[model samples]
Target: MGPLRDFRPPRGILVASSITAAAVTYLAALGRLELLTTGNFASSQQVTAGADLQVANLRPAAEQQQQQHQQHQQQAHQQQQPSGIDTGLALSRLEFEKAGAYPQVTSQRAAAGIDDGVVAPQQQQQQQQRLVFEEKLQELASAADREDEVAHSRLLWERRWQQLWPGQAWGSEPKCQEWQASIRPRDFRSTWVEERLRGLPAQSGVEIGACQLRVSMPDNVQMRYVDKSADAEFLKSQCFAKDGAQRPDIVDDATRLALIEDESFDLLVAAHVLEHMQDVLGTLRHWLRVVKKGGLVFLALPDLCDFKYPFGDRLRLVATPAHFVEEFQDQNASRRNFEGHVLEQGVSVAGIDSLRAASGLPALNRTGNLEDLESITRNFVAMNADADRLTTKMTVPLNLAYSTMEHFGSYCEDHPHNVHFHLWTRNSMHGMLSAATELFRPLGLTFVVEELHTAGRTEYNMQELRVALRRTG
Candidate 1:
């Protein structure tokens, strides 16, 4: 072929060429593409040939070059494998793609008013500087994210302080000092089982909503997993149960436990289940009734202040013992209680009501009825929108208010079983249990907190509060 002049590459070839160029910078970061000292890649002859170069032709040249390189240095033979090739730079294909998306060197050269295909030394330097700037920007962004996480944690800690001691300013009390010092984060699971339950003459026990048994029972104990239904199909149909979740041994109401005889079991376990109960006192009484005297009732629940539940429980104050007492007195669901939960959790009221109506159940309206769907939908939309705008409650905008309303709506609609009726802290749980013991004393059933494991921290960053109550009646 005569000396090619003004030869323009095919579109496919140009795209492949740009990809190859980008790949060099990309692989260089991984220390895959080594620098060729000969500088033949950008030479005048190669530049002329670049216009008509095919991918097939390019691969052979690269292979030949690598073979020659291996022959020249046997020491680098092992390190120069195509699979493990490293270019000794920290660039990614995406970075290259984003920097110019396909930084065509020929186009760049022409833009800089260069007739020759080779880039000027000054232009090369500028390109290197740009890459360095991008890397530095990434590092700065990562550091800022870390700082934001720490600041948010501190803010939540401050909010927790306010919830515990309402109207009391942060860092202004001796109680706060004492509380901060007393936080010794730990996992209390083994402590309760080893100390309280191991040596006991416990024979049989039942666990409510036992997807996977939380605690390890003694070898002699026969533990039965319990849920609303024993049928696999029914369990799968429920919103909470994941695929292959443990099937329940007994089908019964969680609050009543009508099938389980009074004072029949030696032990009772309910992990992450109590919060779903509408009447906390009634549930406790039922739980106490099932377990024989001196038998332990193990309870584990999420802490209200935990960072894990930022959507709802973390935002609202812990439900007081008095509030629970009222719930116990009135077994029916109240509008105020439902409304507060919906707003705090960013859940949809229409979703809840729709499900309730579909199931032939009465509306959760002791006060707030579903007279107007538009108004209720508006309330849901408005609350979440305001939260996203104002609060640090959401680190990433999940669009739960508008776009993702369907998701939260479906959550309420599909799974009408339970939501967190009450959020608890260590102190709040203790107070409630203490009040429950006295209030239910007339029924000839009582229990005392045997061991409380509200540890400072656990593997989950924060441990849920677990309490072992021993039946005394």
Candidate 2:
């Protein structure tokens, strides 16, 4: 105890000792006297100081942390909901309600851009609903536009179909109905022709030439048949021959016939006969001559463009005169002499001279006879030469020109007598008739076209063109 043995703690212990003393001082300031009254006051003071310090320093911080965590959870919950709801306004309203400040809270929320304080979520919900409504309206508008387009297309097709087959229902004829029932597709033009023919008025008197029985005259009409064959046996042999008992009224040739008087017939019907004539223009002129003024000439012929061959060379069958001559020359001549000269001219002249000499004719008589013979020979030679030149150089238009004689001969020899000489389209037929009118006007033959019917189908499917012409003058 001399100077109170100066008891200084170690540096590490000094820090601990200082902490204990400060803790005790803080506790004593709070007035806990029980610690000073105890015999083990130092130990008790250390323990109590630690407890008090922990409560004072860490409790407020922990509470503050818990409150902040709760706020974060509420914000997170609000964010998870739909975009329409607002958490800040709801929380403010709750706080103000607890504090009993209703009017103030509403005014504050309004200043901060909330409409009616509690109605913020409702406004957001309405905005979202409006956007959805606009999207639905756009979809409906697009659907309506598509429907309108389909309706317009349907109407257009209906109009076109009506125009094509006017006054007749599609596929409704007896023949077409049968075909539909059998599931077989026939050419529609055939049906169209049938309908048109059925619709025609009955004639008082009609003359039909080369009646093959494929088409018939109107019922109860006075009909006259003009056929090339008058022999019953020969007529019976034809495919469309009349019965052996019934005979034709007027049996005459189609090309050259003077049996009927001029303007004798009311309606001159020539079905599929104009194509067989060697001279179509001459035949037409003759027809016009025979028909009465203002009378109808119903002419039907196979359109060359409508015929199809498997080999596609059928079109070439409509040959020019030059083609016929060339072909005939190639087949008949030993040596191809297109100039209308004999292959061996010397032999032919010598044979003629020897024949004259062997006959013992007088010199003057022989000379006269030889001169006449030479003249005859020269005339024949000139005729042949002219024919050759015509055939070689001439080309008739497809619309006006018919089959060559050579083509017809070959066709008769090899196959059936059916041959198409020319090709014609609707426009071509119209143009040909118009040209004929001009060409024959100078000859006092006036022909006017009354009506024309062309099948509405492709060239191959189209069978014929029907033209009704009247001789006006």
lDDT of 2 by residue, 1-473 (tens): 00000000001111110112322332343223242222112232342343344334434644465346457756987755411112222222233223332210112233336443345665654443333333322332332234332222211112212111110111111111111122123344324334534545654444444433424444534567776666766554432233442356877766655687778776677666664444456567777878778766877654433322111111122323332233323443212222111101111121222222222321112223221324333433332233212211111111111112122123222212122333344445666677678767887889789776544323222245667898998
Worst 10 residues of 2 by lDDT: 1-10
| Per-residue error (Å), model 1, residue 235 | 2.8
lDDT of each: 0.47, 0.37
Clashing pairs in 2: 322-391, 403-421
Per-residue accuracy of model 1 over 355-472 as CA lDDT, tens digit each: 2332233434323432233434344333333332322221211111221223343333223344555667667777788889778898999778877655554432234677889998
